[model samples]
Target chain A: MDEKDGCGQDGQSTPGVNIMASMEGRGPSCLNVDKDALAGHEKPGFKLCSYVDSFSETHAGRIPIVKSGLGKEDLFSTVYVRWGIRRHDYKVVPGLYGIGHPDRASEVLVTANFKLTFDHLRRALPHISAWILVLDTKGINVWCAAGKGTFSTRELVKRIEACSLEKIVDHKRVIVPQLGATGVSAADVKKQSGFRVVYGPIRAKDIPAFLKNNRTADKPMRQVTFTLYERFVLTPVELKNALKPAFIAALVLFVVSGVGPGGFSFSGAWERGLLAVLALVTGIFSGGFVTPVLLPYIPFREFAAKGIIAGSVFAILLMVAISSAINGMAGFGALFLFSMAISSFLAMNFTGTTPFTSPSGVEKEMKRFIPVQVVALAVSSGLWIYSAF
Target chain B: MKNLRYLDNVSTLVLDDEKCVGCSLCTEVCPHAVFEMAQNRALIVDLNACMECGACVTNCPSGAISVSPGVG
Candidate 1:
């Protein structure tokens, strides 16, 4: 442990239990490689790296915890969509293991096997020692896993038998995330595992308080708080994921204008580079960052639609400025094509995160909008070619 | 909207009434208000509006619900 490392507000590595190993295979130490800016303050020793800047988060509250048999750095982390429709596939593993030396009487808290879910749960309860029974939800978060049948009664019962949870903990009560209430039947879990399922807070921060107050979730604890901080922390990964496709498409458009013969020319290709980058970066911020911040208030309802609307507005503004300074319809063509690409890409990606979008809905959007986007690109390219000629 | 006629009317959710224990977890998690409880059982009041997050089908106690997508 680094002496200067910031251990959150409570000076503990996690809220309720000692973080043994994360699902991303992190050991005792964490290094935030692609950590987002939203992570409040970094404790020097905290290691972080993600397929998408997975770390760089800080807790505003506290909970109790103890390290499992797994060390700190070797623990697992990172979220991956392995199968289809963005199903989670990473986790801290399930089963009974030695966390804080096999405390015989420790409370049992169950969570999804998702690495991020495991990390937040461990981080929030850093002060308490307990048994964290990870349910195999294919690396999904507790709430999501619960709704996915991965944390259902049958699985819970099987896991209990497999891990012999009754043999380890003296308590007959198992704390489960309220969000997981979707997938779990408290009574059914009780009938199968002999442990009373107590629903915990929606956010991990309130875990310590809930446990201290006789393990009960208050009305507020049951409420899902999608606060600004929560949404902000997710931006880095989405933005980074979007960067590659944006640049490649922009370069192609610019090169076509510069190197094409007759209807296409390279004379203005260099000038369009900075302009393309500006449109792309602006579109990204509008859809990836700004729209999410204003999600609830954005017009036209659906998350993807809202993002597109935002991107369109920004694109219009960009075109207005370009048209005034450069005086050409090529700028408008580029503006339309770029905005369509950026917005559509961002909107399609919403399938990974939003709670309301269905697989069917996403599929429908792709079928309808993809053709429009392709035609838009074709038209824009044609326009550029004609102007060059 | 072009090739798909049921895009606005089809739901991927299926309820195995035999497995359902009448828990309202599905109703609470669905933001679009696709389900409602009736006679200690969940009824899809607005099947066309379901987002298909699998919250209900996955969370059912008796394993009552099954979901598949169709343009319908």
Candidate 2:
């Protein structure tokens, strides 16, 4: 299961943690490695950690992390090592990095100029000697860099010039990942730099094998796999983001209800309020996290709509139980309204992830669904107000 | 063959034949099959269908393609 598909590199957690926590059920979203603290190592030893080849901390940005002490120990091994949690952290300038002496004529691989992108690529190639010339895509992934134009021809040429690739590699050829096909020109590189660009497999792991098989990627290697593991990692970020608003709303519901004398009673309001908190959290989680994981098998592909349906069902069950158990005021009307509100929140966040969704699709969804959500919330609020009286 | 055109103002997804050296460089880099060779020349076949993913422009050997949007 290649881990590249987990919502790319967006970390969980948005902001206002305290407010969201008071409500219960906040959004999902962390970092870093101290060598002595790791499980496998103690004494002064090398740790497997990704270094961000380049990034800016001036704004909030992620540094891909790779822990220490994980590669093969054999002196002549050309194998890649795996250890700790391979985090997309560690920032540095995009270029060839030599943890040890890189034999000048070994292999020259191409990757995104982004610090995290470069970090991940190099970290995977641990224990191997190679020259990595990162294209300047201004901190973007390979697929996105191709789309955005930053990872296109000029930059590849520029990076090649900057790295002095011609001087470094004796062979007049460079191996590029297939994902960069959307931007790199093979023949043009050959003409200008006298280095024919050879596309390797879509993944870095396959690079060693691709080279072993004489610099060629099979068609299967060219295809991107959207596997289960890829989808699973993304679930956390979606859930993490939703947790904030969901919890805040629940807590406000709890604290506000307790303000009145009879409503705030420990035995009376406490249990009821707690139930509501649970319901809200469940609704949000169902919509954001659970719904997405079950996206393909969960009946619908329209992410937001699927999220809403899932959230709505969770909310209904929750509200119904609360109403029946506590003999509370939320009858059919309030239940309908509030359930829809939770559903809408989940639906809204689906856009943060999910491929195949275009800008137009998002606009259409917002147009049709946002109104319904606002109306439902308003109706729920009105019903709550009416019930209180 | 798809009739491709570059939206130069918006992105670096175009090919200037004047600078193009008749090398099949752009065609090789574009994963989406956006570029095609016509009479030993490179052309953008499906201009409207282009997602503006900067493949052709980046690998253009003659510095013919440019994805000029954000200031470098």
Candidate 3:
């Protein structure tokens, strides 16, 4: 029997078998199927198959039956992406992928090529059979990719044509993540490709609930919230980025602190340099880690203001802990200003990561506070150098 | 967007109702639900919720919506 029209024991079309047959070039309407293929094996509810072809130089066109659970490589890639190692380049090739055992009637969900995004979408629906249409966003997450226009109408149309989604799926609907809405114009997608775009929930975890409710997203699912947990999770990468600059600044301070009135003294320099380094580290933590976690509770909407408050608290504690080591008022003032400036700058940088801050708001805040921070840092550095002499 | 309002009165999003053809494209593209349709015209329901991603403006075929890109 032709697998496309084949039915299961319940008299329903065998979606799993049909999809597998199509992949293996056994389906009546199969296209782009390579001659080099492996044998297919059947399980209780689904079948497994593989094929290899060269569609494009970049993609070797090795289509493997996508399994439900993640493999060891997926786990390692998730961790690496979280740690921001090769994060921008970590992506799966964008194309049509069968998640469970989707047939023509099954839902087609769109996502970015960013591996984390693809993994999250697949993991969310372990039981349900579906089709995942990944767009080429150059390994960026949905929200950022949408903003950059990579997860766009043009790419979506291009991918749809390349994957021949029109021929595979019986439906003319594509469900896109709510975050990708910024880049994809549903009307334009409809105009360009004959498919209707249905925006799904803001979070991948809500996909089950969304589909359960007849693909209708509730207000909560549509709403985007950046809670403490959300902010805390993003801090790892922020902290990592801050460490490089923090180390370089500390090294410079160590050498500069050694230039005393009677020439360089290693012992005296080590003590002062250690104190300065501690202050810098404290500043980085306050701005990069503390500010984000306590964002909602922070007094002001402006990130720099929040950082200033956080930085002041840390600086005060440091001063009280090392009051006896201070040689003069200049040293104390310099340390305080330096800590505050560093914290404020780092906090301001976080505006880019947050969902709340707008491009205009960031610009306004930067225009108002960056000059002040620059002046403070310059004065602090001059004071520190003068105190060393 | 409840309990997640950003800065007050700072959004650069501007909607020209006169030019709006009431296609409702802005309502569909905004992730934050910043726009709503009333009487077949788009209205900025929650201006503070706008992150200025420019989705609405970009998708607005009638040239009714415009926002300063970097002002968000």
Clashes of each: 65, 56, 6
Q: Report the candidate with higher TM-score, 1 versus 2.
A: 1
Q: Rank the candidates by TM-score, best first.
A: 3, 1, 2
Which segments of model 1 are wrong by more than 4 Å?
A5-106, A126-129, A136-140, A143-159, A171-173, A178-201, A208-225, A260-267, B1-50, B62-66, B70-72
Model 2: per-residue Cα lDDT over A192-255, one tens digit each: 6677778777777677677778876654564444455656666665665665676678767666
1 or 3: which has the higher TM-score?
3
Tens-digit lDDT track of model 1 for B1-72: 111112364456777667778877666544455678899888888776665655465456577777775441
CAPRI quality band, candidate 2: incorrect
**For candidate 3, lDDT tens digit of each residue in A14-108?**
22322343444543322223222233422487423322111121132323445443433566677877778888798887887776556668898
RMSD of 1: 10.0
Q: Could you give the candidate ranking by lDDT, starting with the highest?
A: 3, 1, 2
Q: Which candidate gets the maximum TM-score versus the true structure?
A: 3
Candidate 1's DockQ: 0.22
* Residue pairs with clashing backbones, model 3: A358-B72, A359-B70, A359-B71, A359-B72, A360-B71, A360-B72
Clashes of 1: 65
The candidate scoring highest on lDDT is 3
TM-scores across all candidates?
Answer: 0.67, 0.60, 0.84
With candidate 1 superimposed using the best TM-score fit, by how many Å does residue A23's alpha carbon deviate from the native? 30
Candidate 2, residue A374: the lDDT equals 81
